[model samples]
Target: MTDASISHLQVLDWGLLIYDDALKLQEALVSERIAELSPDRLILVEHPPVVTIGRSGSLDDLRESEEAINRKGASVFHVDRGGMATFHGPGQLVAYPIVKLQTKDLRLYLQMLLETVAAVLRSYGLASEFRGRNPGVWAGAAKIASVGVACRRWVTYHGIALNVNADLRWFESINPCGDPDGKVTSMERELGQSVDMAEVKDRFTRAFCRIFGYATPPEVRQRPTERPSWLVLSPSCTESIDRMESVLSWLRLSTVCQSARCPNLGECFARGTATFMILGTICTRTCRFCAVDKGKPDAVDGGEPERIAQAVQLLRLKHAVITSVTRDDLPDGGAEHFVRTVEKVRECCPDVSVEVLVPDFRGSLKALQRICDIRPDVFNHNVETVKRLYPIVRPKARYQRSLGILEYAGKHGLIVKSGIMLGLGETEQEILEAITDLRRTGCSFLTLGQYLAPSKEHFPVSRYVSPAEFEEWAQIARSEGFKKVAAGPLVRSSYRAGEMVCSMRQPLKSYQSKG
Candidate 1:
């Protein structure tokens, strides 16, 4: 027996085989042969009508009993892999690559497999992704490809199954991969057309070669030699510095926080307060008065919640405001992530208070329910400007929808807050109407501030309201029964958010007691 170290072998086009039946035996046979070969090799195989179970599989997922499975001319066997149970049959291409891991990193291998399958599917005009926390090639929310592999002695055994032109009815007989709630679909299901299996196999081979050949082995890099600059300041100064640091750290994580350009960041940081940006940085829709970059956004980061939690802990923040760029990209409008981040922050620092400035979620009641379920201390949604200017100032968002979101939060007993920017070419009557709309929504907190044009390329500012006008608006907002009203040149959403939320609770409680 040649004991050649697997890493020393430079792999080329290895081997391929197709089996029409006995899939479990085929997998076992291939695995045994690859072990005997004991070097780097790629083996492509196709299985006949069969069902395989992974490590997380349950027998209940199968419709037929073990004896019935054999009587039906198919077989069932539990295998070592990650996902649950799934069906393998003729017309589906299953690749069982027996490649030894030189780097011993399973995550990198899984990611590579996902990208390779997605690339192959994309060639056929199919969009796919390995959505975070989901282990497969997904076309939208349906699984097009399933992956389950096991590594023994750092050598992989089981591999992936791409549903090219497979009969999907078999999936109905069982909870495919034991995911009772998940829908099992194929390329045919998505395109409403049959796919050519032979052509798909060819594409898969080419894609595999391209991805594996060029794939760089995972590596661990040394930490940065230089330490980050640490700023020391007085108790007041420390708060401001910490707040800025939290926001900066959040931005570095590639999530969205509207670069608020609030003049009060310095002061808030001095008080050790920060406004956390959740979801992602890009907005699905553009608003005229805001400085947040608007465009087609990338996918929401699943790790954002944990990072926000870590930021709260790192800053030792007593109060944090979590806000996000509008994410019409998601069905939930990123409300789930917002709730998750809030929950995580509360878990990390139970004493700290959390405020969520959420989007309208396209008036999704389910989305609102998901957020209300979290029971954040405050729920804020900005109207941006008056209803008359809504079309031009906040075109994609409806004025009524914003009101509804705040109303829903209030109805659920959350402290509801909304803000409007002045100097958007609105009349005093329009401003009053907007305030009335907000009050009708049961919003107890109001913030009115001058709208400063972020850039010359952006929407031009119509006018900057004078300090006297802001004061008058504040008075009007108070008269409208807003428990806490802040109107000024520099007030932005989440600016001194803790102070606002803290101040409103007393008056609201008192009002409720009187009633």
Candidate 2:
């Protein structure tokens, strides 16, 4: 006989089915054929109505009784997926692939599934990812797709349940995917709109084919080409950055410059300057550009003030910049911690000037008073961007409230400073207006820098500001009555901050001497 031709290998089109009862029947059929099929078959099936319990699932998680489930005319079955219980009903697409893996690695197989689903979701204008330790495509903490599978004799059965336009209310009946507190969400929930089931199925099928190394069917391969740049630090700088970061880790402190994934982290760390993020890493409000984990606040760490002081002392920092996540979750927006931290830094490092970069405290005068009472050497609050971009750029913060905070600090005898990021789709006039607003607030110092996207998942950068433009902006800010201005590509609220503050103080000191 002629040598066996691999070119003659059959390329089977993925079979699609849409019915509630089809899941149980198809799963049983795939499981039965696992050992018998010479070449594994790939089947894509959609569920009409069902609840599934995975290997580690518990019946107690189900709010409805077995009789209640039966009465609803849906069946519940145990699955091999590595999650807890989940509800699948009409309008959800469930894909079951019964195929032998080209590679025997289960992890790689799972990654392929996730990438495939992510590609499909991208086509529909949804941004999603596989969160580490989480077994689904999440648009934050909400689950949009669930994957569960059983592999035996190197053949895979069971698969993923993607929530397209499913009624999410059904998921609330049980602790979805097992955790009682776990929140169940769908594509419709995130997008605030419905998607066509046929379109979803067709797009997903093409994604699966492309991912599995099969030639894409001509009709489904036209993917949108909008690649976002991934912001990452160079590996050569990791050692140097990590050495500085070791100090923060030792003190259990957080830095938004790191946590928010600032693009200039390497340069700052190499220079041995770090922006100390206090009041814990958890933020109260969710902003689109920020990467800080948002949720209910953590309790204030009383010892944090002293610890930060000790770190500043140990690092021999001549000027220390302290900042915090938006702590609206706290009654005082963590202003007390800011005050205490500033005080401790002053006490311990008597020669070190303290600069505080703080939130607006939800426009609370009392909170502003608490921080001002500490008399930080430099009281800096960022306007972040122009008023026009405020809603989209800093959704939870108010531009007026921020300006008020700066003015209040200045009026209270503190050296007030403010900064804004450019390249956020803001116009030059808007920038000039913002500079004028800062001046009206009595801000003595202003810093400006480009807004580089921290992650692809975050907001895209509208443009990058060149060095020459930054210098011109700095000149404009100075002419607009800012006592000192620093604007450049690498400029940040705390960039080369000690030198800048020292330069500003020299002129003030000389003027006082002359007086």
**Each model's TM-score, in the order given?**
0.51, 0.53
- Please write out the lDDT profile of model 2 over residues 255-328, one tens digit for every residue: 77788776677766666566899988888887766778889877888899899988887766777889998887
Candidate-wise lDDT, in order: 0.70, 0.73
All candidates: CA RMSD in angstroms?
Answer: 23.9, 19.1
How far is 297's C-alpha from truth in model 1 (Å)?
1.6
lDDT of 2: 0.73
Q: Give the C-alpha miss distance for residue 61 in model 2, angstroms.
A: 36
Q: Encode model 1's per-residue lDDT on 95-170: one tens digit a residue.
A: 6666666667899888887787898888878888776665888888788888988877766767888887778777
How well does candidate 1 score on lDDT at residue 280?
A: 65
The number of the candidate with the highest lDDT is 2
Q: Which ten residues in a row have the lowest lDDT in candidate 1?
A: 219-228
